[model samples]
Target chain A: MNVLRAIYNFIFELGDTALLFLKALYWSFRPPYRWRELFKQMEKFGVSSVSVVFITSLFTGMVLALETYTGLKKFNAESVIGSIVAVSMFRELGPVLTALVVTGRAGSAMAAELGTMRVTEQIDAMYTMAVDPIHYLVVPRLITGVTMLPVLTVISDLLGVIGGYFVSIVLLKINSHTYIRQMLNHTDLHDLYSGLVKAAVFGLLISLICCYKGLSTKGGAEGVGRSTTQAVVISSVVVLVADYFLTAFMF
Target chain B: MVEETVIQVINLYKSFGKQQVLKGVSFSVKKGELFYIIGKSGEGKSVLLKHIVGLITPDKGKVLIEGMDIHQATGVDALKLRRKIGMVFQYGALFDSMTVYENIAFPLREHFSLSEKEIAEIVKEKLALVELEGIERKMPSELSGGMRKRVALARALALNPGILLYDEPTTGLDPLLTEEIDNLIKDTRDKTGVTSVVVSHDIWSVIKFADRVAYLANGRIEFIGTPEEMLETDNQMLKRFICARLEDKLMTSLFNACRSRGSCTS
Candidate 1:
């Protein structure tokens, strides 16, 4: 019975989330466009997140290069370490790690802020004032998430490749010429495009889930805390799960 | 002249899971009347007010604002109807992200194409009406509880709404602040002639300003009448409710007097 109840709740909430997505789309295209709020959210989720995404992606690439060198040297494939790091960074680590970092940072903040507004009746106040909360609140964040994630992923991919180069030549004593030639010959622009596509999808999912958790929040401070935690947990898990399918289809 | 009803609830029934909050509750507010819904906390006074604004839909009835059923109103119709009603929440509910100036200007900006100068003029006028001028740049967090309520009132009045709903406007205020808010509500109604509905358990506020009072208990309105009529009622439940308040007030006054004399005892 408990398992059945859990499944039932899962399907119900999934349907609710889909409905919220449709409503967000519906409101987004209509005007009295909140350009100010959209720009504000873009700066928050995109610009403010640059430092963390940079650090995370750069270190991830360096670690990947180190591990790949140790493994490939046994098989005499050490010259291809640059290609491995580049492909991995562009196809998976860059987007996924960037998304995960952002989920923890901006996504949780979105949930907490919206959840606070919900508990304090600020959302209700907006609704009563003849402004649709979906338009005034959800749409701006949705646009920011969809647009900013891919931009962040591009930065992440670039820094990641640079980090891998530093690790390969400076640390692993690999030839710089061979590293660049092999990496360029092995990877294509398609790899970067697919990764950016994944980033955009991740952005949408994270913002939608966080915004939904927030707007549905009840019970005041405790409820806001719960929603923020759930937003991070659910969006982080969704990013990983979606990454698998995206990689399978793209590759 | 007979006052027309601006707000009405007919046979409203709402339940949350197993807890039935409103069971067939019904009432109407006449034009320009200062109506109060008085009940204990958690008795669904706020819930009933939310119905009027269409924030919470009823499981079984109709809430009509100016004869248009709010639940049935859709899209632009719903927005138009909502513009006619303004609600001041218990905690002020000012947008924490915006300053008092932006908060007051929000509704005007959304509904009209008024220029910055016009919006500023109206915002100042509303602030002055609430007796809170020249604090527009202050954030909601910067204001005291009473000041927050005043700013909320200023924002609610920005559009010159036809009907105003206040959910426990004086709930967390001190005695002097409570009187100030009550007076503000009274003054607002007198000046604007906007039909007002206030949901509160503050018996003193009800007595001080309510032109009519509805006592909500046991998921229904047990009494609906003037403050004088409510005080002189024979209904046992109402008498108990009023007597409990009177007794509490009496005890508070006695304790205060003792403390003032430095003869207070537990």
Candidate 2:
């Protein structure tokens, strides 16, 4: 019986998420564009997050270079470290890791803010005012997430490659020209595009899940806390799981 | 003027999980009436208000607002019906991110195409209506409790909605502030002639200002009548509820009086 209930709940949540996504999409095309809200959300989720994404991606690239150099040196292939790091960052690490960081940062913040609004009856106030909460709240965030994650992922990819180049040349004693050439030859614009597509998908999932959690929050402050945590946890897991399929489909 | 029923709930039923909140609840509010639904916490008074506002769909019932069955209405129809009603939530529910001016101007901006100057004029008018002036730039968090509720009231009245819903409007307020809100609600109804539906446990407020009162208990409305009728009721459950609240109010008043005289000990 408990297992049955679990399955039912999972299906219910899946249907709910799908419905919310469709509603958000419908409202995004509708009039009353809410440009102010969209720009605010873009700044919040994308531009404000540049420093954290930069640091994380840079270190991730540096660490990847370090790890790959030791392994490739066994086969006299240490020269390929830059290529491996660049390809990994472009196709996999950049989008997935940036999304993970954002899920923790902006996603949780979205959930918490909306959850507070839910608990405080601000969302209900919107409903009473003849404003659809989906149009007013979710659409802006959804647009931001879908648009900004790619921009952040681009930054991440660039920073990651730069970090990898620095490590390859300065730390690993590889020539800077060799490192740059190898990275350029091995990675393509398609790799960057694929990562960006993945980022957009991840962004959609994160914003939708977080906003849904927020809007549906019950109980009160404790409920807000629960929703925020669930938004981060579920979106993080979804990002990683989606990354695998995206990588396979794209590459 | 001929009386008209502006809001009606018929045999409303709602359940969350295993707990049923509203069971066969039915009531009607006449146009320009100050109707109050009084019950203890968790008795689903707010739930019923939500139904009337088209915020919640009942499992089995009809909520008609201005003669349109709200639940059965389509997208545009629902929005059109909802626009005629304004709701002030318990904690004010002002948008925390926006300034007080922006909060009052939000519904106006959303439902109409108005220049910022026009919106500002309306916002100023609403602020003046609420007797709050010249604090438009402050966030909701900056306002006192009474100020927040008044701002919420201004926002609710911005579109000049035909019906107004107040959910526990005096819940956290002190006695003086509670009276102030109660009087504000009465003044709003008096001045605008808008139908008012208030969900609260404030027996004194209902006794003083309500044109009609409904007592909700045991997942249903146990009594519905004028406050005089409620005061003279033979229904034991409702009498107990009213007496209990009255007794509390009396004690608080007595305590305050004694404290003022410097002759009381708890």
* Clashes by residue pair, model 1: none
Poorly placed runs, candidate 2 (over 4 Å): B245-266
What digit string (tens of lDDT, one per residue) describes model 1 on residues A81-195? 9999999999999899999999999999999999999999999999999999999999999999999999999999999999999999998899999999999999999989999
lDDT of each: 0.92, 0.89
lDDT of 1 at A119: 98
**Model 1, residue B16: C-alpha shift (Å):** 0.7
Off by over 4 Å in 1: B245-266
Cα deviation at A21, candidate 2, in Å, is 0.7
Candidate 2 local lDDT, residue B49: 88
Q: Score candidate 1 by TM-score against the native.
A: 0.95
> Given the true complex, what DockQ would model 1 score?
0.81
Top of the candidates by DockQ? 2
DockQ of each: 0.81, 0.82
